[model samples]
Target: MKTTGSPAGTGETAGSEANGAGGAPLRLWGGRFAGGPAEALAKLSVSVHFDWRLAPYDLLASKAHARVLYRAELLDDAELAAMLGALDDVGADVAAGRFTATIEDEDVHTALERALVERLGTLGGKLRAGRSRNDQVATDLRLYLRAAVRQVAAVLTELSEALVDVAEEHVATPAPGMTHLQHAQPISFGHQILAHVHAFARDVDRLRDWDRRAAVCALGAGALAGSSLPLDPEGVAAELGFDRAFANSIDAVSDRDFAAEFLFAAAMIGVHLSRLGEEIVLWTSREFGWVELDDAFATGSSIMPQKKNPDVGELARGKSGRLIGALTGLLATLKGLPLAYDRDLQEDKEPVFDAVDTLLVVLPAVTGTVATMKVRTERVAAAAPDGFSLATDVAEYLVRRGVPFRSAHEAVGALVAWCVEHDADLGEVSDAQLAAINPAFTPDVRDVLSVAGALDARSAPGGTAPARVREQIANLRPTLAADHKWAVG
Candidate 1:
């Protein structure tokens, strides 16, 4: 732990000087260079500021690496014991904020190594004997992402449950279902809400799929090629909760596909969330007035006294772009690289890290927003009856009266045009007028065109009927509950 530098100061003056040996300087990667990095460059190039999030994963990987070395007989029992104990101490220090992470360490890996070497002397050097930063970082990223994916899935489950709760409350409430932004039919509000819950349910399942694929161990890949030492990668994998070890040593260190795959999953989840956010924004708008945001989730504009903007929803929508960009960035970074570890691969962590952070913030907040939201049932029902949402039912009634489907469609289409010209809803038309438009349109035509009748007629599975929506909600409850339990447990 000797250094050729001068004693460093602690204030403004210290900020410009090179760090000395005992001043909590970065001592991990300075072996080849005789001098320390410029203070400015050290502050700029180091990632310990943000990458400190990797500390737990780094310690976990180190313990597994230590066990591998011990099994390989590179360390005696005492050295193995000391390494394990020191690593545990390092983990504790990191967790308790007793650790000094300096700007010159470049990354969490270097900071951890420097701390370990300082704590345990030359015995710490034995930990890296058969591993390289290439494999080490790969292992750390996988471990970090594995835990992050699970956490995000947990948040997603909470969000899904929130939607399910809304569905449970609004199971009988009817709302206008739109296609091309035009009201197509009357659907239960519960069905509309559960549709998003299902989308997010698939998203949770996808994250689990990506996590499974991303959980392989690359610990002993060792810089690229197979290592000269007889290390058991499988043992490291087992220690780290990985189901398997990578078969190709070169690919193990070089592959960022798992990271990109995780980014892909994150991007898709973001898109689903953005869609949900968009609906919340729209439903709260003056035009729709179908839902009200809780005060805690709404923000007011400084100049506009009446503004209660859904800024969180807007931000969630904006963040989807960042997640999608991260996915694309990682894809481009890996596109033309040759097999086995490239410096370019170092750029991989930031994007996925940002995505995990964004989702963690967005998902839970979204869940809270959904959980406390107030659905405007009367407003929804008022809007539901006015938008020609029951036109399909009128067409169906004509079909039931022995008119051909195409003929019924034309008859209803002409009726809708007449109603539009007369500035009236289909329900405002008299039964005589309906029969005049098409003799197949009997007295039941007017009844069928009512919003409730429109919903009732469509009683098939996956339909918008209250009975069908309740069935769907009932079916979803146990499955989502099972998933939530599995994710948390």
Candidate 2:
């Protein structure tokens, strides 16, 4: 990806316009406009600044769309050969930085089409014979987003694996788990890490679903209806690796619900990452001091020499706002549109583009943070004291000794009050204090209050016990491996 600010260059030229280092001049749409757009409006409206990322997907889609045109008998074998060659040349030029995309075209679609026409003459126009920019754009979006979601999924898997690695290393470490930002229970540190790993696994599933929905081909839906030509949309779909052709031309061009769903999925993933980022920032702070970020992933403040800021994490937490904005912007744009085709749909590309780019970068940085950080096991275990955390354990102990559950809960509640009045930890309460609340509280109740015993007793399929989490990790291996193959292949 290109840096945010760079010198502009002159390259692709259309009509009287000149290409800049940034991208092409507005020469692609020559048949319609007699006068050029105002310079400010041109700069403001040109998407070449961001849409360049779609160049590869656009070229691939063009090739598939062209072959479909050839099969429909609109073009001879020679014409098809020439168009394919020209498109290959275009793809290479774009990849090698030799092709300058002109701004005359509204987007990568027109820019590439115009370039094809320039190279292959009237034959290039034949590529669009049965395809409109409507279906064409939709097809390009699916192709691009499918690949992008896979990339994001791979990054998520890396992050998940990193969390799992951390969990494995800290399997015996203990910490306080909080609710409402106060200590609620003592949980294994490994268990907490696995919790996020599980959340991210579900996130991977959500992206996979989006990719499946976006995999349908929209190539033969010209304008608002089926084309008059005998186009083989399914053949194009197969060539482009789509699972199937779209069932309706009107729906194909009009529907952006796929894109909306993708944004929604990505937005939820971003929210999840943000929650994790917030915790990392909190844990690394001097007050908490439960973890230490490596110097490579941390930054020192300009004025505060002692400050080791979790900038990467804090920035990730902040970036969710951008993803949320993208989701909101796209939904708002689609909410009241009269479809089939509308210029309003043109606004769709930027947000989808931005959201994908943001997550691709953020996920990896988060993964790095997870992989390199040092967990302060001593501090974490030290903070895992028996207090309010044992209240439920005490209640359960009474229940096991034949007291009814509600009565046991009330008895534990009174014992907690006694401990609080005596300024004592639950573990420090005496046998006399135990009987004062309930005779069911025997000496073994003290053993039940230990964090290790509490974790072991909770063992079940999805429980926080070390053995249960190990089993959970074992099950994740084949599932994650299968998904990795699907994404990479």
Q: Total clashing residue pairs per candidate?
A: 0, 16
Every candidate's lDDT: 0.82, 0.80
The residue pairs in collision within model 1 are none
lDDT of 2 by residue, 225-262 (tens): 88889889888889899999999889999899988898
TM-scores of the models, in the order given:
0.91, 0.91
- Where model 2 places Cα greater than 4 Å from the true spot, the runs are 1-45
